[model samples]
Every structure is written in structure tokens, then in C-alpha cells.
Target: MGLVLAAGAGRRLRPYTDTLPKALVPIDATTTVLDLTLANYAEVGITDVAIVVGYAADAIAGRVNDFQDRYGVTLELVPNDKALTWNNAYSLWCARDLLSQGVMLANGDTVHPASVQRTLLDARGEDRQIILALDTEKSLAEEEMKVIWTSENGVRTITKLMDPAEATGEYIGVTLIEPDAAAALTEALKLTWQRDPNLYYEDGYQLLADQGLRIDVAPIGKVDWVEIDNHDDLARAREIVCPS
Candidate 1:
């Protein structure tokens, strides 16, 4: 399977990124945010990785390439030149040729070993798209881009995180998709982002759900992942990964 690391302007994590990309910011003596995610995937048997780079992509590219050179993994590069303008769906679409069989999509800003393992394990038997959902110590808010399900069945509905119903929790930015679903999602992205240039990947997934696609939410029970949105997130994540 393939993995697409969504690349974009991390406007939320400023100042630190005033000089460096968020993904390249150091977490510890041994890892960066993106490095931890990449290493997690490697541990769980993901060999082929395609990282979509933009928004200070050169550093992301250099760091990942350096690691790949040392570790010998199949690390491919896909550029989201429009990352400044478009959302993550467009990033994955740019790398569709590398995802012919199927692929996993990840948020470059979040990293944790358990979270990576859970996403891969949960997506194992799925025949369709599987979006990773996490329940947490603090409930994810209505603006965090969440996923929810009402079915005794495993299939679910992913919304903009603004729906009144309390979700299991937030998206961990991990999604598994077969090639057909990936193609369908890209097509949906075309329609969704045509009128509005600021569309996110959630927009495409919502389009798929609206059209009756079987999008499964792979629930990861309160796990050890961290989403680096701001300085606090960075500090907290660094503490978790680099408690010295």
C-alpha cells in the first residue's frame, strides 16, 4: 500500500515555522514529527511511502530523503505545488499514479506509534475506504473535522465535525482506501473544490458519504497520538517522544 503525507501551509503553527517547516521541527534527539510517523509505518510493515511535499517542502524532502537513504525504504516524492491554495485531497490526487493498488493517507503533523499501528490493523479487512477515528481524554469539538456512526454495522458517516451528534472523536488524519475509492475521491474532489478553492479532504469524503459510499470509521480507543497544531502541541509531543 501507498501512503500520502498531506503537505500544506501550517498556518496554525506559526513563528517556529517562520524559519522551518512544522514536519521538520525536532521532536527529540532522534526524531522529527514526520520522522516519527514514517518510522511508525516502517515498524508496522509499510514499505512504500509517498510524501506529498509543499509549504517548506524542501526541508521535508531533505530530511525524509536522508532517512530513506539510510534505511532503504521506497520513499517517493509528490509535489503539492498548489498546497498553498488547495486542501489535502488535492495533495493525494497529485500522487494518484503511485496509488494504483490502494493507499493510506496521513497528516504529516500528527505522530504516534500506536496510532499508526491501529490505522493499519483496522484497515486490514476493509474492502472500501477506512477513515481512522480516535476517542480521547478530551472530546473532540464541532470544528475539528470529526467522524461519527449510528449503525450497528461498521459503515459510518463522516461530517465536517459541526454536526450536533457527539462523535467518537476527531480524525487522526489517517485514511485507508482501495484504488477505486481513491479515484472516486479524486473525482469528488474535482467537483467539491471547483467552486471553492479552500476545500479540505473532508469535503471530498463528505461528498462520497452523501453519495452513499461505504466509509468505515476505524475507531482507535484513547491512544498515544498527538496532533501538532500549535506551540503547545509541539512542546507536548516533544515531551512524550523525548522525555529526557
Candidate 2:
């Protein structure tokens, strides 16, 4: 199953998000971020997808049929009522019931090619509990969710608090969680939200790592992708989405 966390109000994007969720904002004239996400999953033959919705949920809820018809996939809408007050940890936790099933977690506001999903899915490792899609070639920034890890075997020390200079890669807001890691990840996410409702889902990954869960990374070498957070990012996404 594929899970999309689309609950954030994206206040930084202001006027653009005034009526629509960040996921609904178009990267190009025809394609929105969520459109591309569903397409990515469909390309990988994943049909059943769950989307956590909040912050003008109607915008997305209203278009559910259209999205399903357009993508040839089934979308289960998971509502997060506290989206305006709490962070994405809560939004993720809202879908706890679906944790047992293997899930490909993606942030609804990120835009990337289907190969990002294909690469992570194609990597074979029976022992890896969770796999994160990373962009090792991108320039690190404070805004990016940076990771500092020993690449000896797989990625380690997956967190965003590290200084950009010390980071090994930038997590591109995508993760593949196998069944073995589902329960632990769900517990960690619960603890993270209970401790602080403002924490991000990335904090849950850190907690899992502290408990010795191996959250590995699949570096997307030189891939064109962007997370639309603000107007500047939207501009960059437009360029990446429709390059001349």
C-alpha cells in the first residue's frame, strides 16, 4: 500500500494554500504534486493508496473520484482533524491502522519522477526494515531533512538536526516501510506525537533508530526532484517539472 501525508496547511506558501492544500498546487499547468505521486505508485503497479487529509480537506476530498479515475488507483482518505494545531507526526499517526501492511510513505507536497519509487522498491534486502529515498547529490541546506550516516553497510543516523556540513544526504520525504518495521515505526510515531504534537514524522524515524531499527537509505543520484514548501520552491518545481 502507498500512504501519502497531505495534512499540512503549508502556511509558508500563504496565498497559494489559502484555498488548496499544498498537494493540490500545480507544479505544471496540468499536474499537481499528488497527481504525480499517484502516478508514481501506479507506474510501480501499486493500486491501493491511502492519503491523510487535512487543511481544506474538501479540496482533495472533492476530487477523490477524479484522482482515482485519472490514476487508475484506489484512494482511501484518512482524515486528520487536528492538522491546523498539530504537526505531521499526528497526521501520520492517524493512519496507524494501516501500519501492519507494507507501505510506501510519501509526502504529498514533494514532486519526483516514478524512478524514485522504482529505485527504492527494486533494491533487494530482506533484513532492511525501512528504506528512505535520499538525494546524495543535492546541496545540503538547513531546510532540507539532512542525514548523517555511516554508509559502511547501509544508512545510519537518520535525522534532520545535524549541521548541513556534517550531513551525508538529504531525505527526500519518501520512505518504504516493510512489514517487519511497521509495528516499531507505528509505536515510535505514537511516542513522538504523545511527547510533542509539534514534532515531525522524521522524529519518529530517529526514535526507531535509537531503538536499533535499521532505516537504510537509497541515494537518488543526480535525480531531479523538489519539495514545494514556499514560493521559491514552487518556482524551482515548475522548472524541474517542465524543463526547457
**TM-score of each candidate structure, all chains considered together:** 0.87, 0.96
Clashing pairs for model 2 are: none
**Model 2 misplaced regions, further than 4 Å:** 152-155
Clashing pairs in 1: none
Model 1 spans with C-alpha error above 4 angstroms: 136-138, 152-157, 160-165
TM-score of 1: 0.87
Span of 10 residues, lowest total lDDT, candidate 2 = 151-160
Report the lDDT tens digits of candidate 2 across residue range 1-244: 9999998888898888999899998777788899999999999998999999999999999999999999999999999999999999889999988878989999998989989998889774868788899898988877889887675545556666778888889999998888888788889999999999999999998888778777788887888898998999999889988888
Question: How much does candidate 2 score in TM-score?
Answer: 0.96
Score residue 151 of candidate 1 by CA lDDT: 51
RMSD of each: 2.4, 1.3
